[model samples]
Target: MTRLVVIGNGMVGARFVEDVLSADTAGRYDVTVIGSEGCEPYNRVLLSEVVAGKHDFSALTLPTPDSPRLTVLRGTHAVRLDREDRHVETADAARVRYDRLVLATGSDARVPGLTGLRNREGLTSGVHALRTIDDAREIVAATLNARRAVVLGAGVLGMEAACGLARRGVAVTVVHPAAALMERQLDEDASRVVESAMTGLGIDQRVGRGAVEALVAHGRLTGLLLDDGEVVPAELLVLATGTVPSTALAADAGLAVDRGVVVGDDLSSPTDHRVAALGDCAQPPEGGSGLVAQGWEQSRRLAARLCSPALSATFASGSAKAVPDRDPTSNVSDVVRLKAHGLDVVTMGVCGSQRTDDPAQRTLHLSDPDLGRHVEVVVSGGLLVGATCVGAGPVAAELVTTYTRRTPVPSDPAHLLISALTPQPRGATGSVADLPDDATVCRCNGVSKAAIVSCVHDGAATVDQVAAGTRATTGCGGCVDDVCALLAAVSTPAPGEPTDSPTTSRPREDDVTKGKHMIHSAETAGS
Candidate 1:
């Protein structure tokens, strides 16, 4: 049996293991998964929920360890990769041999270089960044004792972290170098709406200022010093500045490194075809695709190559194309990318590559400032090129799909966001009758409508239960609202029967701890 040694048991790595184990391949590989975290993989994207007190430790799990061929080593770090010897050394000096290697060493949040920030015990805490499940646990623990929190970035993470603390009744403030928040994913008009929504939730948004130094009184963080000579006081400081690829291990091994560990299209390291990298550490042809979807895809490609080497990849096989190139078939299989903030925002296929200034290019811009809503639909050459939405509704994903499929702009493109505004959208992606027999109702793992309906008929109540039964609405969660609707159609007892809540279908302890991607995608307004 071939042995596969996978490192960094985070989302992408854990996903690779699940895929390989579940696949009906020619031969099973002996899997050795090395995890730096003390526990099995959990959803890091939902760190905000942990901070918000919606879930303590109960709601975070990536996948399970059940395969007989799998040997999981938690709290062990891979100290070195020896390609010549076909072995890897854990930090404790245990060596494991492998026919193939997968590096899913996902990134860590970039802790900014701040001066004198400290914790309550009168010790310098420095900068705070959240990128792992353990990091979330620590931040949640710290927030309990913190009365005020200052986040030093207005990106999605900063906003989520800031808002989560605010939701828990902590005084929260966000500082951004840009004038607006989420500037990379949002435009001026849409950003205004998002800012309004956040401010309405009681988050202090600060811009055009940098923390010159952190104020530590005798060892604990008391406040931050501004470049403008202003002292802003807060009990805790979180630096959501950004992230860099976690590549120290790969770099030590002398693998090709750019923004990340440079790998070919098939995710094979340039130095050794026997070695492959997946997840945040491996920079695929797209060159360090920061999106989890891209990382998951790389894992899929590497798994296929390792388990079923004869099959050719759909995309360019050997020399990889840059991730920036728009491939119409990027959705050959379903992919779930989790970047959870309060907003249901999605960026796909070359964001901001739009002809905004051209009068000839058809564009529809709609905004209701009172509701903090803005939707921009730009159609050029009959392809839904780009869109931006920040508001009281769920239009970002709906618009992203239109742009992804190059869907024909309706006679009234304005209806794209409004058409699906049913109190609870059901069978609206396409008509139940017109949907091809293969169209997925639960797009997480490409479970078709027939599969879901069959499960509902087979005994599933409430959307959450159906999610466990069908694995639908468990990918990007864009479909959970629809799954809930399907549950409404499922046969149910008449009145007086207790309904499903967090009690009946709380998911098996194992499922909550490890089964599949529960974080899914960003929250659908209804989920």
Candidate 2:
């Protein structure tokens, strides 16, 4: 049997193993996964929820069910790769042989260029980075004694850490170099709404400035010295600056390394056909968004390629094959959503301030600072190309679905938001039933309405069962309502069924289905 050795047991690596095992059920390959973390793969996306006291460590861990064909080596770090011998040297001095190697090495949190970050030993006290589950736990423990805490960076991780700490009654302040929060994703208008909403949540924000130094006095962190000569008092500092792709192993092995490990259209290393890369560590020739959904797509596609009969024959013949363009997840939604309570933010596609010269481009902006609501839309060719929604309530989900499905908009785009806040008029342009089956319901997993319907037909009668079977509403949990809507639309209830249960009957405006319950389940699934 061909041996497949996978480095890094992150979400991407674990998922690739799952896809491989599911496809190669005949046990054609002996698979071994080398994980740096000691525990089973857990969802890193929900790490903020863990710090918020919403989920325990074990709750976030993914399943690694026993299989005769698979072996998982937890807490094993690959230190060196010998491509000639097709073996990897682990930190523990053990060597793992492989016919094929997959580098899903993921990424590492980037710490700011600050002084006194460490002594002879690594990572001084009162300083932490929220990258791993262990890091979240450390931050959570620090919050217990931290009356005042400062999170450096106004990006997603920083905002998430700030919100999580504030939720636990810790006085939190976020310092970012960018003028607006999540500036890369949200426009200035949407950022202002989110900033105001977060301020009300007991989190202070300082923008357009960054920390100059991590101040350490007598073996303990006092606070951070800002670039503007202002010192922020804090007992704890959580650095959510950003992450850099972990590409050392690939680079050392003589593989092409750019911003990340360079891979072809097939997710295989350009210099080595026996090797492949995925997740944050990989930069595919067609490009990548560094999103989990994209990583999942790479994992799934790579698995299919490795298990294909053509691949087996080509491998035996030592023949070269052209990398076909079969990546479907690339078209997945670029929506950046926050799952925090009382903060509903979704930023997708282009929300930039600069107006495009293209006549086909249409931009709409709405901002109500008092109500803390912001909405921006960029339409090209009569379809939404970009959108940002802040505190738009359930209308945010509706807008996302409309955008994802490429449904025709009303003559007035503002009507989209209006219909969401209040009851729709007698005649509305779009409804859930009108959505195409091919339209992606779960953007993170690339799950379409037809897939959910097929799952329902395959004994996935309930929402949770559908999630388990098809991975709908799994990532980001933003599409839970969509999944529920599709479930109610497709599922047929038994005779004398309650109105609350799944039914073939179309969803009425007044009928309260199991949508909220399913959404809650989806939101808290990995929590």
Tens-digit per-residue lDDT, 1-527, candidate 2: 99999999998899889888987866799999999999989888878878877667875777675789898999879999999999999999999999999999999999766896776677778999999999998998888888999999877667777888888999988998887888877766677788899889988888888788888889888888888999898889988888999999999999999999999877888899999999899998767676787788777677767777666454334332311222132245366776665577776677644345677777777789899988877787767778778877566667666676567887777676667668666776444445666666666677666777778666565656777887765566556666666666566465777645533444443322544532232121111
lDDT of 1 at 164: 76
Cα lDDT of model 2 overall? 0.76
Q: For candidate 1, write residues 1-527 as lDDT tens digits.
A: 98989898876788788777755255568899999888868766566667766556655665574878989999989999888899999989999999988888877667566667535443366345677666676777787788888898877677767877887788888888775576665666666777777777888777767777888775677888887887878878887888888888888888888878888876788898888888677777656535555565565556655555443343344422221122332242322222343444443332332234776566677777787777666666766666666553356655545654456877766676566443445644543324444444543344555666677666665556676666565444456545554444444434664556322232243433332323435421111
Clashing pairs in 2: none
Candidate 2, run of 10 with poorest lDDT:
518-527
Off by over 4 Å in 1: 117-123, 313-361, 392-401, 411-451, 454-478, 490-527
Top candidate (lDDT): 2
Against the hidden reference, what TM-scores do the models get? 0.82, 0.87
Model 1: lDDT to the true structure: 0.64
Of the candidates shown, which would achieve the greatest TM-score relative to the real structure?
Answer: 2
The runs of at least 3 residues in candidate 2 whose Cα sits more than 4 Å from the true structure, single-residue gaps closed, are 309-330, 353-359, 410-422, 425-437, 453-458, 461-464, 481-527
